[model samples]
Target: MTESRTLYGYFRSSAAYRVRIALNHKGLDYTQAPVSLVKGEQQAPDYLALNPQGLVPALSDNGVLLTQSLAICEYLDEAYPDTPRLLPAEPVARARVRAIAQAIACEIHPLNNLRVLNYLKQELGVDEEARNGWYRHWVELGFAALERTLANSAGPYCFGETVTLADVCLVPQLFNARRFSVDLTPYPRLVAVGEVLERLPAFAAAHPSRQPDAPPA
Candidate 1:
């Protein structure tokens, strides 16, 4: 029997969202320990002990501590090989998916995450409009590249018909883009694929609005 899984994360964190999608797609049952990033709860000494980086999405699987969203997702896949695979079998295809996922997770997300935004406002003295402008700029750049990369999609998901790591990463990034009011008109392929992916059970359940900590509508 698989051991119990516990995920510590902020509801609205894109990185945490990616892990949630991976876990749901694999049909894994995990408990959530909400870390309120907005309130700086991630920095608490207790939380920091769980994750020295003080990042959301630190996971504990039967007492095996895991940090980093991508690493945790890959670990789940490796540990539970019987579950649906997030990375493809073919080498080239797997690399391509990783590239796409990283394009957002590494390049785009780093510049626009909560800490960076707070640093821009509190440390750099950037105004609201300028801070948002910073967010929109990186999102547009990343989406443009992703749109072109996915121009050859066979349909229904990021990598052909199967949901891969790319799709998991894409959904949360797009959600963040919309949250920041970034214009998505420039990336039709992204918008269309995202709409389809969001309809899936795994993706839908992992949405920020559906998370337990989300504010009431």
Candidate 2:
């Protein structure tokens, strides 16, 4: 039997969103322990003990704590292999999926994270215009490359047909782009893929707006 699991995360955290998608995709039942990043709840001592980095989307399963969104998603995939697999079966295809996922998770996200943006404004004294410029710069660069990658694939999803790690990564990043008002009209394939993926129950239920911690509407 699978051990009881809990996830500590913020509603708007893209990293946390990735885990939520994975959990739903795997058909696993878990509880959410909301950590408010905007209000600085992630830095509280109690939360700090769970994740020294003070990041949202930390997972606890059977008393084992796991941080880092991608690692946590992979752990879920490994621990529960029977349900819909997050990674592809073929070696090359799996690598391709991982590559696309990492491109967003590792490259684009780090530069635009809350802490990084705070640094730009608080430390570097950047104006709001410049800060927004920084955000758009990385997102456009990443999406341009991803658009080319997806153009070659058959998709209502990122890879062939099934939702894989790439789709999980893409949807959240696209959400972030829209949150910041990034013009997505240029990346037709990525936008199209996201439109379809967002309609799926797994993706729909994992949306930030639907999370329990989401702000009062």
Candidate 3:
């Protein structure tokens, strides 16, 4: 376990959820500093100093602060080479895994994230129904393409039998999709991959409901 690893995040934030899974999967010890997104804690001056973008997840590794979920996951994989890696050693396989991860993180997530939704509601005054429609549109569009990409996979996970960064990114996005009532029936392959990944101990431990900031049942 590394010393002084602190993750500033919101329990329900998909980006933070990704880092949580990576930390748990690598068997790393880290402390959680919950920055409640719903309560606007991420916008506070303290958090802004850590991450000027006012994002939910900003990891502090022995005071070496890092922002962006994918970058942090990659950092962990590189820093702890002895631990289970989130990326493959082979060039082609590594690129493929990153492609899947980015399809979700870059294409789908950016459109449907909390800030974008809030912008539509608070700034443009979009109605709840339209906001939900907006969410489902981007998810379905991205998942449609992602399903085709994963159709050739011979695996229980996104890339293969071995879990990679792709698997880590998929589970949290699925959780967020379900929260918005997005119909996942169109992407059975993606959904199947997600179901298998979610059952794993690390993924289960990183679930939003399992976080310390999560609401009591």
- How big is the positional error of residue 138 in model 3, measured in Å on the Cα after superposition? 0.3
TM-score of 2: 0.97
Q: Please state every model's RMSD to the true fold in angstroms.
A: 0.9, 1.0, 1.1
Q: Across residues 20-46, which tens digit of lDDT does each residue of candidate 1 receive? A: 999999999999999999899999999
Per-model TM-score versus the true fold: 0.98, 0.97, 0.98
Flag clash pairs in model 2: none
Score each candidate by Cα lDDT. Answer: 0.93, 0.93, 0.94
Candidate 1 lands at a TM-score of: 0.98
lDDT ranking of the models: 3, 1, 2
Give the winner by lDDT.
3
Mind giving the per-residue lDDT tens digits that candidate 2 earns over 1-217? 6678899998899999999999998899899999999899999999999999989889998789999999998888898889899898899999999999999999999999999999999999999999999999999999999999888888588998899999999999999999999999999999989999999999999999999989778
Locate the minimum summed-lDDT window of 10 residues in model 1: 152-161
